[model samples]
Target: MHFKDLFVNVSETLSFTTILLGVGYLAAFIVSVLVISENRSPAKTLAYLLLFFLLPFLGIIIYYVFGENYRKKKLYRLKALEDEKLQKRLNAYVYQRSEEKLKENELQLKDYEKLVRLLTYEGRFPLTDNNHVQILINGEEKFPVLFDALENAKHHIHIEYYIIEEGFIVDRLFDILFKKAAEGVEIRLIYDDFGCSLSKKFLKKIAEANIRAVPFYKIHIPFLSNRQNYRDHRKIVVIDGEVGFVGGINLSDKYQNEGMNNELFWRDTHLKIEGEAVRSLQLFFALNWSFCTDEGLFFQNEYFPKYEHAGDKKVQIAVSGPDSDHASIMLSYLSAISSARKCVYLTTPYFIPNESILNALKNAALSRLDVKLLVPGISDSRFVNAASQSYYEELLECGVRIFRYKKGFVHAKTMIVDDVISMVGTANMDIRSFDLNFEVNAVVFDEEINQQLKQVFLEDLHQSREISTAYWHRRRWFKHFFESMCRLLSPIL
Candidate 1:
C-alpha cells in the first residue's frame, strides 16, 4: 500500500473522467449543429456553433430552449399546407380579376404593374380595386377611428394583437367588446401569449362574456415551449367583414402619447381600410384563428361577407411568417425599393436590414434616387439600437440619408416608393420581423395615398436629426467596437 501507487491510480482515474466529459461535450455540440442547421441561415448556424463551442453546457441548454427549429415541426407544416391549399384555390381567380382591372385602367396602373405582379406571383397577395384607405398617423388618430368602427360593429368583431396590456385604452376596448358581445355580436380574439401575458382570470372573463378568445400558439409548458420565438406580431381589427385596421400600433397605453409617460411620446402609423381590401385582412385573421384554436373556421361566410363598394384605392395584403419559405414582406419592400424611379422613403424603429434589403437600398441610392430612412434616436433595446447604427456609415456612404427621430420613438414601419406605392404594417426592417414573426402589411398602389405618406415622412423629418456621413465616420472608437459586436449578433437578434 505505497503512497506513490495510490497517487498514480488517482491521477489515471481523473484523466479518464476528463476524457469522458470531453466526449460528451463533443456529442452535444454535434447534435446541436445538426438540428440548428435544418432551417437556420449560415450566419445563424455559425453563431450558434460558436456559442456551443465556447460554453458547451450552457449553449446546449440555450439551443434546446431557443434554437429548436420550429419550421421542422409538424404543427407548422400542417398550417403551411392548409394555407397553400387555400391560396391555390383562390389565386387563379384573383389574378385573372386583377389582370382585367389593370386592362380597364391600364394608364392609371401602368407604372405599378410590375410591382403588382411581383406581389401577386411571389407573395400571393392579389391587388383589389374599389378599396378605401385612411392613413392614421399614430394611436391618437387611429384609436378613435378604431373605437368608432368597433362601436358600429353590427354582425361580428375580430381582433388580433401582439400586445394587449391592461390599460386605459384596453379597458375601454374591452368594455366596448363586452357590450357588443352582449348585443348578440359575434366576437373573436387572438392575442399572443408571450406578448399579451394576460392572466387566466382575464382570459376567462373575456370567454365568459361571450367573446371567443384564444392565445396564438399557446405555450402550454412555459419555458419548455420552443414556439416562443415565433410570435404572432400582427395587429388587426376587423368589424363586420367590412372595415379593418392593421399596423404597428398595439393595444396599449404606450402607443398613445397622452397615456404614455411624461418623458415618452409614441409615434406610429396604422391604416384603416374599407372595401374588398378588408376581406384580405379578414382572411388573415381567420387563418391565424384557425391555426391557433385548431378550428376549421376559414370557411365561415360571416368572416368573409360580401362587401359593398367603398372607394377606388387598390390594395393588397402581404403576409410573411416562419411558415413560409421566403420573407414575403421583406421581399415586397426590396421590390418596391428596387423599382423606385423617383424616391424611396422608409421609417422603422429597428433598422437591422438583411443583405437583400441593404443591397436594394444601396443600389437605389447609387442610382441617384432620393432614399431616406428614419429611425428612432433612442430605442427600447440598446443592442438593437447599436446594431441599427452599425449600418449608418455604409448607407450614408452610398448616398442614403439617415435620420433619427428626436421627438420620440418612431415605432412606425412604413415604406413609400416613387409616390406611387406605400406600405404600412407590423413588420420592421429587421430579421426578427421578417423571418420569425407573423406579420401582415397593407400594400397600397395609389398615387394619392403614396403622396400622403410622403408628406407624413417629410413632416417626421422635421422632428428628426439627420446623421451626416462625416458624423457617422467620426464616431468614437469604443462606440464603433460596441456597435460592431451588436452587428455580429444582429442575425439572431
Candidate 2:
C-alpha cells in the first residue's frame, strides 16, 4: 500500500493505453494510404478516409468488409479467356460484317454512331441486325411470354437471376423446369447467394429433378462475408439459343402485381429478344456459368445455334461488372445522355448517380434538352431514397424535370434517348449497379421500339408527381441537411 507503488501502477496503465492508441492510429493511417493508392474516385477515397479516421477500429472493420477496391478479375479471368476464344471461333463472320453493320447503323441512327462504337469497343458487345425485340411492361406481360418460351425449350434453358423467391410464380417456374428436365432438355440455373433465399428442401428438389443449379459467389456466413459486396444482379433467360429475356424483373411473385390487393405494384421493363441478340445473352450466361461451376459451355453448338433472320430490329447487349475492364454500363449511359439531341427520359428505382452522370443530366438540361427523370416515391430503402433526393435540387436548378412515381415502386431501369435508342436492363443509375454488380442491358436501335418505350415513359409521367424547383426548395431545412449528409456517403453506399 505504498504511495510510490500506487504511482508506478498508474503510470504503467497510462503507458499501455497510450501505446494502444498509437498502434490504432498507425493502422488507420496505413489503411487510409492504401485506400488512396487504390486510385478510386475522389468522393469514394474521401468517404473511406473519413470513415477510417473518425470511427477508429469500427471504420477499419467496415472498410475491410466493403471498402477494399478489389476487382473480381482473377476469378473471372478464365471466363474472359474462354469468351475471347469463343468469340474468335464462332463470331469471326459477325466481326467481319461488324464494320459494314457499323456503317449501316451510322446511317440509320445518325447521332448514335459514336455511342454504338463505344459499346462495341468498350463493352465488347457487337451491334447485331436481324433482331426482333418486344418491350414487355411489368411481370404480367413478361411472365406469360417467358413461360411460353420456357415451355418451348427444345434444346437447353439457361436461367440466371438475382432473386428467385419461393412463391406461386416460382412454383410454376419449377413445374415447367421439371417437365423440361424430364423431357431430357438440359436446364441450368444460377441464382445470387446474397439476393435469394433458397430453402434447403427446395434446393434438394431442384437436385432431385435433375436440373443443374448453382449460386453465384456463395456465402456461408452473412456477417463475415466480404464477398457479399460484389453481386450478380443480372436477370437473364436464354432458351434454346433462339429466345432471350433480360431486364430488372427477378423471378419473384412480388414482381407480378396480379391478384394483389394492398401489395405495391412493381413497375418494371423486360426485353424479349429473338435473333442474334439471344446469342449475346447466352454468351453472358455461359461466362457466368463457367465462373460459378467451372463448366465450359463455349463449344455447345445447340447453345449458340444459328438464327435465320428473326427480324429487322438492331440490338446490342451492354454488360459490366468488376470483372469487366471498364464500367461499360455507366459509360453507355453517359454516352446516351451526352448524345441526346432532343430528349433524355430515364426511369429507375434507384438514382444515386456518380459525378459524370449527375453532371451530364445537368448539362443536358442546361442545353435546353428535354431531360426527364422518374424515380420511386416509396423506396424500399430510406437511405437510398434520401441520397437520391439530394441530387434533385441541383438537377432541378439546372432545369431538369424530376418526377416521383406514386402508384408503386417503379423498378424499371429504362432510358429513351431522342427516339434513337432504348435501354432496358438491370443496371440502376447508382454506383452499385455501375461498379459492383454484374449487369446487362439490351440496347435497341429501332425507331419502333424507341417510340414504344418513349410512349410508355410518357404514360408513366401521368402517374408521377413532377417536382418543381419552387416546391423542392421550399422543403424543410432538416430534410435537406439529412439528404446532403447521406449524399456525402453515396459513393460507398
Scanning candidate 1 in windows of ten residues, the lowest lDDT window is 72-81
Summarize candidate 1's per-residue lDDT along 1-493 as a digit string, tens digits.
Answer: 7999999999999999899779768967787758565857777776677667766777777777776777645355435336676657777867886787778779877877776777777666678988989999888899899999999999999999999998788989999999999999999999998899677888889989999998888787777766778889999999998999999999988888865674788899999999998887887787787687777765567778777779999898898888877788888888888788999999999989988899999999999999999999978999999999989898999999999999988999999988678999999999889888889999998899999999999999999999998888888999999998788778777
The model with the greatest TM-score is: 2
The parts of candidate 2 lying over 4 Å away from their true place are 1-24, 78-94
Residue pairs of candidate 1 with colliding backbone atoms: none
lDDT of 1: 0.85
Looking at model 2, the pairs that clash are: none
State each candidate's clash count. 0, 0
- Evaluate all candidate structures by whole-model CA lDDT and list the values in order: 0.85, 0.88
Candidate that scores best on lDDT: 2
Q: Write the per-residue lDDT of candidate 2 for residues 1-493, one digit (tens) a residue.
A: 8999999999999999989878878899999988888888898888888877777688889888876667833455536455577657545655555567887767777788778877776666678998998989998899999999999989899999999999878998999999999999999999999999899999999999999999999988888767777889999999999999999999888988987453788999999999998888888888788889877556568888889979999898999988888899999999999999899999999999999999999999999999999999989999889999999999999989999999899999999998778999999999999988889999998889999999999999999899999999899999999998888888888
